[model samples]
Structures are given as C-alpha cells and as structure tokens.
Target chain A: MIRFFTNVWNNFKEYIVLVILILASLIILSQNKSPQVQKVRAIAFGSFATFTSIISDMFSVTDLKRENQQLRERNAELMIQISKLRKYGIINEELKDLLGFKDTANVPLIPATIISRSLSMTQNMLTLNAGRKHGVLPGMPVVNDRGFIGIVHSVSEDFSIARTLNNVDLKLTVMDERSRINGIMKWTGEELVIINIPNTFDIKIGDRIVTSGISSIVPLPLPVGIVEEFRPSETSGFSYIKVKPFVDLKPIENVFIIAEVQSKQKKDLELNFYRRQSDEIR
Target chain B: MKFDKIFPFLIFFVGLLVQVTIIPLVSINGIVPDLILIMLVYYSITRGQLYGTVLGAYYGLSVDLITGSLLGSAMLSKTLAGFIAGYFSTETKRDINISTFNFSMIVFLCSMIDTLIFSFFSAFDFNTNFVTVLFEHALLPSLYTGVVSILFIFSPFRRKRLL
Candidate 1:
C-alpha cells in the first residue's frame, strides 16, 4: 500500500497540486463579498498603491505641460458657463423659495489624482491618491472636466479603487436628456449599451444620456454618455442603444470625487414602504 | 540556485509595476499586453511545472487583490497557463526554447489560454458573441504579449546569465 501510494504521488503530484490550487481559488472567489476578504483586499491594495503612486508621480511630470494647457482652456470655458448659469440660479432660487423646495446643491467635491490604472477588457479599474484619510469613500462618483468617470469601489488609508464605466460589473440607471426616458446602462464587454428599451421608445441617435435621479448609487443627475447607435432587435421588440462616453478615461489624470452616497432618509422610507407592503401580503 | 529560485518573484513585482503604471499609456483600444503572463511563461520554461503552477497562482491572486479584478478569475486562468507552459520545460530543449523564436510562440499560446480562461470567468455569457470576445479579449492581447516576449530573446543579459 505504501509503495502504491508513493508511485501515485510521484507521477501525479503536479496534477494534485493544480487541482488543490484551483479549488482554493474557487473558494476565495466565493468569499469575495465577506468582510474579512474585503479587509484583506483593502490592506493589500493600500500597501501596493503606495509604491505605485511614486512611479506614477514620476511619469506624470512629463505630461504636466500639456495638461496645464488643457486645464487653462477648460477654465475659460467654465468661466463663461458659470456666468450664464448664475443668471438662471437667481431666478431658480426665487422659484424654489416660492415652491418651498429643498436645496440639493451642497454636495462636496474632493480632488484627487489617478495614481494607477488596471486596464482590462471587462474589469478596468483606477487607483486614486485619495482615500479614507482624505474623506473618500466607496460608492462616491468620480468625475473629470469631461464628465462622470467611475464610482469608487474600495478605500484604504491613502488610496481608493474605482470601477470605470468600461467595467462589466457596473450597471447604472441612465436617462435620455431629450426624451426623459430611463434605461439600465452597462458595459457589454464590447461597448456601453442600454438594454431592454422597447422599440417604440423615443430614443434617437446623438441623444445625451445622464445618470437618473432615481438611481440609488448616484441620486443626482450627471452626464454619462451620448447615444452612438440604436439598433432594434430583429426578433424582439427591444432596442439596443450604444453610448459614447464623454470622458476618455485613458488620458485623464485628475478627477473630483462627489463625496455623497444615497441619503439614508430616502433609503429608510423605501425600506419601510416595502416592509408595510410585505406585511399586508402576509 | 537560491537566487535563481527567488528571482522570478522579483521579476513578477517589476512586471506588475510596469503593467499597472506604464502599460496603460501604451494600450491600443483598451487592450494591453499581459506582462505578468509573459514573465510567467519565461520562468515556467526555465523552472519545472510544479514551480510554475504555484507561482502562477500567487501572481494571479496578487493581481486580483491589487487590481480589483474578480478574486479567483486570474488565479484559475494563470494556474492553467503555467501548467501548459511547463510542458515545454524538458531539459533537452529548454535552452533552445528560450534562445530562439520559439519562446515568442510559446508565450503567444500560453497568453491566449490565459486570457480566454480569465475572460470566461469574468465576462462570458450566453448572449455574448464568442467570435468577437475571442478576437478582442484573447487574440489581440496574446499577440501583443508574444511580440513583447521577443525582447527577452535579445536582452543584453540573456537567459541563465542574468540569474
């Protein structure tokens, strides 16, 4: 029996190890959402991001001249837009006062620079220099001058990771600015697509898409993308809408984190309503 | 020999550093070469299969944790890739494999499998177009990694000399 066992071990040891590691990986995959795993992941990435930020800082210096020029141009553009918006703001405040509407413009923005990026077809992620120490938190939206970039996924002491719009795992509720129609938008590995819109919907090519106010992840509306293509399914009544994002994530360096999550009051109200409905059913 | 055993891990860290920091700058249409896979293939050819398999798991898990990819996706793909690459590690042809164009070919093959398995775990669905996924996620990245591996053949410090 010992000799037989030794022969099997010598001949198939590689296969045995491979199977063991494969099983270990699957177990880890299943534990991805556990708090302990999340803690370990946060620590691991936090330590690595410190080293990566140094390398990123060295490379960013070479692009400073070009970035400076672009920022100057963008500043001028925003100056003109802000002047125009100020006129509307005064009238809007007076109208809001008359209607007794609550102000929602007090959201804070935290500035940060992209320290590194993990570029993949389906899992594109960005590491930023802001984290818990900087008041950055998961689920906050990261934006640039162009528009929305991504949502913060994880945070540590000095760094945070963001899931970009190109990542397959992120799904968002977006609306058409012109038509006021809402749809679920996601990265399809090949493109950004708004799925399950009926063919009769009023969406058209070149319509601007923005985050919907109804979305739990991002309650405030923000520019997302523009509809690039609208194809109706041949067999089904649904249409497929492709979006071209305003922000070209590859070249972006600095971004602002909109330091907000869904309001707790709203969440609690919704939860209470659901509880009442379930109680009635019971 | 001790230095040689520890050397691949050091290369993995440097490769990972370049992957996350510098590789994005050179990305073509959001597709970049897998620098870690190329290094894994190189070391698997030099080392034995068991060593390659274990290293692949370590490298893949680290990438998943740090890069925010699905935790086990890369781990599974890279382990299989390392095992396949180790098949070419026979003593008789090991030198010939590293010194010649064959190294690039092996890298290409292993990279394709690596990317395919990784994509399967992360992105595959019934509605997806298999051909497009194969072309974009598997082929392009593997070709890029393979082309980059050609540099190893011509490095100033050649195989066995560097270690």
Candidate 2:
C-alpha cells in the first residue's frame, strides 16, 4: 500500500497538488465572510495600500495643474449655482418651518483620495486613503460631486476598500426620478441595470435614477445614474433598464465618504415592527 | 538556484504594483491586461508543472487577499491556468516558447482560463447571458494580456538572461 501511494505521488504529483490547491481555494472562498478572513484581508490591504498611495500620489502630481484649472472653472460654475440654490433654500426653510418638519440633511463628509483601483469586469474595487482613523466605516456611502460611487466594504487603520457601482456583488435600491418607480439596480457585467421593473411602469429612457429613500444601505436620496436603455422582457412581463452613471470611476481621484450608515433608531423600529408581525402570526 | 526560485515572486510583486497603479490608466471599458497572469505564464513555462501549479495558487491567493476580490476566485482560476501553461515547460522547447511569439499565444490561453474561471465564480448570474459574459469578461481581457505579452519577448532583459 505504501509503495502504491509512493507511485501515485511520483506519477501524478502535479495533479495531486493542483487538486489540493484548488480545494484550498474553494474552502477559503467559503470562509470569505468569516471574521478571521476579514481581519486578515484588512491587514493585507492596509499594508499594501501604503505603497500604492505613494505611487498614486506620484502619478497624481503630474495631472494636478490641469485638474487645478478644471476645478477653478468648476468652482466658478458652482458659485453661480450656489447663489441660485440659496434663494430656493431660504424659501424651503420657511416652508419647512411652517410645516413643522425636522431637518436631517446634515451629514459629515470625510475626504479621501483613491490610492489604487482593482478594476475588473465584475468586481471593480477602489482603495481609498481614508479609514477607521478618519471616521470612515463600512457601509458608508462614497460619493463625489457628480454622484454616488459605491459603499465602503472594509476599513483598516489607514485605508478602506469600496465596491464601486460596477461591482456585481453590490445591489442598490434605486428609483426613477420621473416616475418614482423603485427597482433593484446592479452591475450586470456589461452595464448597470435596474432589473425586475414591471412592464407597466412609467420608466423611460432619459429618466434619472436616484437612490431610493427606502434603501437601508443609503437612506439618503442621492443621484445615481440616468436610464439609457429600457428593455422590456415580453415573456417575463418585466423590464431591464440600463443606466449610465453620473460619476466615472476612471478619472475620479478624490471623493467624500458620507460618514453615516442607516440610522440605528430606524433599524430598531423596523426590526420591532417585523417582530410584532411575526408574534401576531404566531 | 535560490535566486532563480525567488525571482518569479519578485516579478509578481512588481507586476502587481504595475497592475494596481499603472494598468488602470490604460483600461478600455473596464478591461485591463492581466500583468500578473502574463508573469505567471512566463514563469510556469520556464519551471516544471508541479512548480507552476503551486506558484499559481500562491499568486492567485495573494491577489485575492491584496486586491480584495472574492477570496478564492483568483486562486482557483490561476491554479488551473498555471497547470495548463506548464504543458509547454519541456526542456527542448522552453527556450523557443519564451523567445518567440508563442509566448503571447500561451499567455492568451492561460489568461482566458484565468479570467473565465474568475468571472464564472464572481459574476455568473442566471439572468446574464453566458456568451456575453464570456466575451466581455474573458475574451477581451485575454486578448489584451496576450497582446501585451508580446513586449516581454522583445525586452532587453529577455535577450540578456534567456538567450
């Protein structure tokens, strides 16, 4: 038996090793959600991101002059828009006061730069320079001036990884700005798509999509994308709406992490409501 | 011999550095060349099959951990890719494979397997069209990696070290 085992090892050693490694990989894949794996991943990326940030900074300096000029022009344009919005803001505040509405719009923003990006067809990720030290936490919404980028996935001491809108694993609840029809939006590998919209929905091409207020991940109604294609599935009686995002991940260097997740009070209220319903059924 | 054994890992780190930092700049429609896979194919062709298989696993796992992709996706894909690339590691043809255009073709083959397995694991959805997934996630990236591998054949270091 020993001799036979030795013969197998000698003849098909490569195959044996391959099978072992593949099995190990599958096992590790299964353990992705385990706390230990997440900790190790955090440490690994945290260490590597230090070097990446230096290299990224080196590249960024060359583009600074051009970016500065663009920013200056954008600042001027924004100044004009801000003045116009100020007039609306005063009227909105007076209206809110008359209606006895509470303000919940003030959320802190943590500024960070993209240190590196792992761009793939499905698992696109960005490493940012902000982390736990900067009050950036997992599930915080990352956005730029243009619009929503993604949710922060993991955070280390000095770095955090975010799954961009292009990542397949990230699904968001978004609504059509015009029709107010809510649908689940996700990256379909080829494009950003809002899936399972009923055919009777009033969504149309050129309609703007925004994060739904009902979404737990991003409770704020933030701009997401514009509907570019509306493919109605005849048999399924549903539509797949393709979206073109306002923020392009490629050229974006700096971003702001909205330092908030779904409110604990809201979550508890929802949980209690579900518990009450379950108890009533019992 | 010790230096030779460690050389591939050094190349992998440098390749990964370039991959994360420089590769994104050249990306077309979110498709970028797999510099790490190109380096893996080169080393696997020079080394034996057993060596290649083990190296591929290490490379894949490292990438997953560092790049924050799905933990085991790259590991599985790269292990198979390395095993397949090892078929051309015969002593008689190693030099020809490395120095000629065949290297690119081999890189293409390995990259296809790598990307296909990765996409299948990370992005496969029942609603998605398989052919579209294959073309966008596997074929285009492999072609880009294969085309980029051509530069390796003509590098000054190739003539200095391999020839």
Candidate 3:
C-alpha cells in the first residue's frame, strides 16, 4: 500500500497540482463579487495598471509624432464646432428662458488607454487604464471617436475591464437610423447580428444602426455599426441582419468612456424588465 | 539546472508581454497566436509530459490572472494539452530535432486541444452555438498558433545547449 501510494504520488503530482489550481481558481472566481475580494483585486489591478501604463508609454514612443498630428487636426475641428455651437447656444438659451426649461449639458468623456486584451477566443474583453479612481463604473458605455466600442464590465482602482461589442456578453438596443425600427444587437460567434427584427422594417444594406437609448445606462443615437445584409425568416416573421461595427477593436488604443449613467433605481427597473423578457422567451 | 526550473516562468512573462504588444500588430481576424502555449509545447517536447503539464498549468493561471478572464479555464485546457504533448517528447535532446515537420505536427495537435477545450469551457454554455464557435473561433486561432510556433523551431535555445 505504501509503495503503491508512493508510485501514484510520483506519477501524478502535476495532475494533482492542476486539480488544486483549478479548484482554487473556481473558488476565487466565484468570490470575485465579494467586497473583500474586490478590494484586494482593485489594489492589485491598480498597481498592475501603473506597470502596464509605463510599458505602453515606452513602447508607443514611435507613434507620438503621428498622434500629435492627429490631435492637432481634431483640436482644429473641435474649435470650429465650438464656435458654431456657441451661436446656437445663445438662440437655444433665449428660447429655453421663454419656455422655462431646464438647462442641459453634454456629459464629459473620460479618456482611457487599452492596456490589455482578452487571451481567450470565446471572450473579447479589454482592460483599460482608467478604473474606479477615474469614476469608471460597470455598465458605462465606452466609445471611440468613430462609434460605440463596448461596455465597462468591472472596475478596479486604476484599471477596468470591458466586454467589447464582439463579445456575447454585450447586448445593445439598436435602431435603424433610416427606418427608425428597433432591434436587439448581439454578437454571434461569427458576426454582429440583429435578430428578430420585424421583416416589415425597411432595413437595407449600408443603413446606419445606432443605440435606441431605451436602455437606462446608455444614451441615444450612439453610432454602433452599418448594416451589411439581412435575410427574412419566413417562419418567424423576423429578419436576421448582419452589421459591420464602426470601431474595429483590434487596432483601437485610445477610447473615451461616457460618464452618462442612469440612476440606480431606473437601471434596476430596466434590468428587471429585460430579465422578465428573457425568462418568458425561455 | 536551477535556471531550467525558473526559465519556464520567465518565458511565460515574456510571452504575455509579446502577446499584448507585438502580436496585436499581426492578429488575424482579432485572434492572436497563443505564445505561451507555444512555449509550453517547446518545453514539453524538450522535457517530458510531467514537467510540461505543470508548466502549462502555471502559465495558464498566470494568463487568467493578468488578463482578467474566467480563471482556470485556460489552466485546465492547457494542462491537458501539456500532458498530451509530453508523450511526443523524446527521452534525449540529441534525438529530437526542433525544426522539423514532426515538431510542427506536435505543436499543431497541442494547440488544437488547448483551443478546443478552452473555447468550449469559456463559451456561454446554453446560448453559444457549439459547432459555430468550434469552427469560427477555435480552428483559426489554433492554426495561427501553429504557424507562429515556427519561430521557436529555429531558436538558439535548446534544452541540451542550455544545460
């Protein structure tokens, strides 16, 4: 018995370690939402965010000049837009005062760098340098200058993780800009698909799709993608439309996290409604 | 000899660094080659299954921790792959030729197993279409990882030379 035990231990030590690690990981993952674990994770990721930031800055020295040039052009365009908006603001304010309306302002964009990307094929998440310290919270919408990129999933102190539009975890209420028809946008393993769109909706190839703003956390008309092609399901009376996302996650480095978020109560209500719909379908 | 014990971890760290910075430049359809898996293959082919499996598990755990993905999925898949690759390892370094068709075949098989298991476990259990993910996601990345394994084939470092 002693000799048999020794032989098994000698032969299967690595397997033993593998099992232990896997169990430990499962425990850790399950406890990720606990406050203590979150605090520890936050501190660790904060330090890691600093380390990765330094590395990214060191490696990105070559792109500095080109980035500077692009920034300059963007700044010039912004200046022009600011001047044009100033004229409209005066007219809008005068009308609002006449109507006794509340003042509205655009939410400021929080800029962040993509620090790391998910290594798994089935998941498409990216880590950003901005985190809770930057007021980044889970469910916040992220966008590049061109269009919507993703949603913030979790936040550490100085680092946060996001599930990109390509990930199955992300689902958006989107609209055909031209047709004004609403649909749910999600990623299949292959492509971004808007399923169950009524066949009556006049969605065509090359039509723009944007956020419907029906979701509490995100705002209206955020550019999502362009329609590629759609096909009607005769039996279901719906269309499966494929979309080409505007922001290609592969090459994106810098992105802005929109600070706009609905109140907790509102968001919770919307979430419950979604859960109910899903349960009913199931 | 002690360096052999530490070298795998060092390679794993370097693999992470290269994967994020350099591999993104050449990603095909948003799928980057798994560099650490390639290292696991190299080490497993040079050493035996036992050593390779342990190293692969550690490598996978490190990746999950750093990348902030679902933990243990990579470790489980990679450990099994390492065990499989260990059988293909020769008893002696002198008997093994790293830069050969046989080496590529071994790497290909190991990557295939790693990706298949990793994708299966990581994917959403109910919602995902298994066959679509198996083909669209796992197959291409495995092929890409196999292609990238060619770089290690002709590298200066070999187990015999290092020793």
Give the candidate number with the greatest DockQ: 2
Query: What lDDT tens digits, residue by residue, belong to model 1 across residues A27-120?
Result: 9989999989889999999999999999988876656745764684464345324433443354466786799866554557777788888858
Q: lDDT scores for all predictions?
A: 0.86, 0.87, 0.73
TM-score, predicted candidate 3 vs. hidden true structure: 0.81
DockQ of each: 0.82, 0.87, 0.49
The candidate, 2 or 3, that scores higher on TM-score is 2
How well is each residue in A85-158 modelled by candidate 2, as lDDT tens digits?
43335456778679996555455777778889985779999999999999989999987777789999999999
Cα lDDT tens digits for candidate 3, A1-282 = 999989988988767765775676567657656777555545655665566676777766657745854674364335324433543454566786798854334556677888777776556888898888889988888877667888987788788988888776577888877777888888875689997778887999998787774655465457788999889889889887999998878877777787767557767787899999999999
Model 2 reaches what TM-score against the true structure?
0.92
Once superposed on the true structure, which residue ranges of model 1 sit more than 4 Å away at CA? A62-99, B160-163
Which ranges of candidate 3 are over 4 A from the true structure?
Answer: A11-45, A61-104, A268-282, B90-99, B123-131, B159-161
When 1 and 3 are scored with TM-score, the better candidate is: 1
- Report the candidate with higher DockQ, 2 versus 3: 2
- Models ranked on TM-score: 1, 2, 3
Better of 1 and 2 by DockQ: 2
Interface RMSD of each: 0.8, 0.8, 2.7
Per-residue CA lDDT of model 3 for B39-84, tens digit only, reads: 8887776777778878878877666666766656677778778877
